[model samples]
Target: MIYKFCPAVLLLILSFSPGNLFFSETKNVKEIAKVIKTSSETNEEAIYNSLNSNQFALPQLESFKEALKGFYILKEKGLISKNILTLIDFSMSSNSKRLWVIDLTTNTILYNSLVAHGRNTGNEFATSFSNSPQSFKSSLGFYATGEIYSGKHGNSLKLDGLEKGINSNARERAVVIHGAEYVSNSFIQNNKRLGRSLGCPALPLELTDKIIQTIKDKSCLFIYFPSDSYKGASKLIS
Candidate 1:
């Protein structure tokens, strides 16, 4: 005599399989949808006020605004989350390399650093880090990640995103936060010029690691400059 299994019994056996049970339990589409929705609601005006209320000069304030505009554009493109913490201001001046950290939520200056910018190459308009193509051949912009190194260069941060324009290839550059003796208020006073980076946003050796940890891994960072051309070119403002 021949016997055949019922179709209902076969279906019951397949449903009890380990693989099917694991797959059904692990898939949670609702949680993923919530995260994406929350990130989309990030407010732009809030981020702008956070940086503007800091102790920035007129030109620096304008640059900060432009940077905020860029951040807003990124938010719209779903490139960043809404929990923007702070915007750092580097005046890029040899006389005063003042750094200000503005709190986005409360619109206040949380931290301030007397940092240094690139030294004068006998060029007044060459105060920016992007001035000398041989030494620092890149424009001022923002980045996501940075790396700390302790080699012959001492302690320094490897800033990413110099090769690609702002918001492009930022993750690949490996830009990092590290300490540098050259980036200090004393350097500006002694040399009448600030220190220059090979393209990195050099900070005081003391605050390098702290800054790096604070703004690493998808954190928003904006480097400012008083250039109308850059402001015009920024898509966030446009």
Candidate 2:
């Protein structure tokens, strides 16, 4: 007679039989996990102070800090390389300059400019989001910036979403950072809001080059929205 082991039991046996096979980071994982757990609480006042000092809008600081927690966890997991962080506040109205690129290492804001959401997201605000291709809706979560390419939108930067089930399909959707004529004050004046993209984070034509160069190649980008689904399901956040 042969004794058969259950899958769960086998997994438990393998976990104990490993030299750091079950968890790669080992001791560092605990430190990182602690940071993530206290992120919202420990970071609130300090992040708000920094945002105020930097002249970043106080209303957006909460979302910024929330996004930073995920970024920190991703960094600790060896997901992103550069200390450059990009943020998109989809909760803001379409006309607001809601995109920010910051150097986390130097604590400097590199760019804060108007970026368009998907055409179908909303008229002046983005509420609906998706990870499906052709949904033409912006997906919320952490992303890693990829290589640059010159396409029909001129110079553009590719983005790879890091989170599963939320924004993992970003690359397949062709959702990229590209320049657009409509992401300007003139367009906003004409239409009462900035022109939206095909789910791409469309930037101003003039600044795409500089922004792309700074954040390209494995940098982190976090598209934030106050959705309950994302907040509950995201693995990078506590």
Best by lDDT: 2
The local distance difference test score of each candidate is: 0.50, 0.82
Q: Give candidate 2's error at residue 108 in angstroms.
A: 1.2
Count clashing residue pairs per candidate: 8, 0
Please name the candidate that would achieve the greatest TM-score relative to the true structure: 2
Worst 10 residues of 2 by lDDT: 1-10
Off by over 4 Å in 2: 1-40, 51-59
Candidate 1 stretches greater than 4 Å from native: 1-60, 82-92, 118-135, 146-176
What TM-score should be assigned to candidate 1? 0.58
For 140-210, candidate 2 gives per-residue lDDT tens digits of 88999999999999989998989898889988999999999999999999999999899999999999999
TM-score, each model?
0.58, 0.80
